[model samples]
Target: MKTFLFRSIIGIFFGAFLAVLFTNAIVIFEGRETLDGALFIKNSIGSILCGWFSAVSPLYFEIPSLKLSQQTALHFVTLFILYFLLAFGIGWIPFTWNSFFITVLIFIVFYLIIWTCFYLYFRQQAKKLNAELTNLQR
Candidate 1:
């Protein structure tokens, strides 16, 4: 558990650095004229990557489980909650949509995309790790 936690922390740190670097690059290349475009893209990507890391960390680095599916489900749930909270927090954009419905729709779509990617990636990793463990046991 300790080792997994350590490695997961390292992964999150690395992921965060990558997010910042990518966001900076976008701002430099895309010019400051389009604040909304740049900020939207940067925020979406950063949040997705953050969600992915948070979701996968438990499965890849932290917990050992008797059933791989169980672990994956737990991780997925955690990621979903984290992403929802993030999306909700940012849902009320300072000056965008006039109606709350449109705002929520946008937020939900963004959250779905990020969550889907996180789920797929976590599933792949869990499968690979479980296979490796099986081989080791054999």
Candidate 2:
């Protein structure tokens, strides 16, 4: 429970940070004259909620399995649903087949990038631990 809440809070802040940065960039790029304060507020809240909901998958491990692929699948599925809701429910993306398809492609690309980073981080940590154990044995 504590882990879940902690992770969720972290997600909330991180998501909001990214939201601000991305939205602002888009606004600037599009040459928008003025920012809609209400829209920004609504979108930020939605993003925070998105983070809260999506963070559960990474911190959750009730299955007691050792299969990395299975764990990754579960995580991806959970995130897919969460992101779909965030996009379609919050009007972040249009309600069209083309939009949905593009959203899915974006999700896949980001998921793979994030997963690869995590995998590399874990591998590095494991290597460090193995080295430490080897040194202790000597």
Candidate 3:
């Protein structure tokens, strides 16, 4: 419970930071001076929720009965839905089929990149641990 709360708080802050950075970039690119207060608040909340879920979703993997693939699928779908809704709601993407397709493609690419990185890292760690165990058994 403590760890969960800690991660949630971390996620909230991360979300807020990303929201600010994203908003700034968009403003600069569009030559905007400022954003509407209500819009800013809405975006901030959305980002926070996304971040919170991103952090907490990994807990799904702790279920011993679930295969790795199942956990991964659930995590992917949950995040995708949350992000798609948020992006569409915030007008970051248009309500068109083409836009949705492109967004999904981009999301999948990024998700794969991240997932692969983590997989390789953990594989490496497992190898190191196995090597250590072999040495100890000698």
Candidate 4:
């Protein structure tokens, strides 16, 4: 729990940085500007909280007795729900059907990228371990 809290706090800073960077980029490219410093501060705080929750929520998943595929699907479903609720709740995006679809799609892509990286890393580790075991047996 302590480590999780620390991770969440770190995620807050990361999320805030990404939020500011993207906001500035949008303003530059899209001509859509924030009205004031206060709005920007509010957005920063909202994004920070959203990041904190997103980073920490996965710790609570406890589905057992399922195959890895089933567990992974459930894990993604949980993430989609968490991202959707938190994003909509924070006013980070609008509440239209189009907005919902776009947000969900983005969330799914984010998770897929993360999972793929982890999968590749672990697969490499497993291959190394198997080769080591083969050498040991020989």
Q: Which candidate wins on lDDT?
A: 3
Residue lDDT tens for model 1, 10-42? 766766666667667877998755556765665
Per-residue lDDT value at 99 in model 3: 87
Show pairs that collide, candidate 1: none
Kindly report which residue stretches of model 4 are placed more than 4 angstroms away from their true locations once superposed.
23-35, 58-67, 136-138
RMSD of each: 7.1, 2.5, 2.0, 3.7
- Write one digit per residue (lDDT tens) for candidate 4, span 1-138: 687878788889888987888788879998985546776777787777767766765554444667667767876877677667766876777999998888777877888898888779989999999999999999
Model 3 misplaced regions, further than 4 Å: 24-32
Per-candidate TM-scores read: 0.45, 0.81, 0.87, 0.67
Which portions of model 2 show Cα errors greater than 4 Å?
A: 22-33, 61-66
- Please state the error at residue 105 of candidate 1 in Å: 13
TM-score of 2: 0.81
Between candidates 2 and 3, name the one with more favorable lDDT: 3
Q: Which candidate, 2 or 4, would have the higher lDDT against the true structure?
A: 2
If ranked by TM-score, best first, what sequence of candidates would result?
3, 2, 4, 1
Q: Rate the local accuracy (lDDT) of all candidates.
A: 0.63, 0.83, 0.90, 0.76
Q: Given candidate 1, what's the lDDT at residue 23?
A: 64
At residue 81, give the lDDT of candidate 1: 61
True-structure Cα RMSD, model 3: 2.0
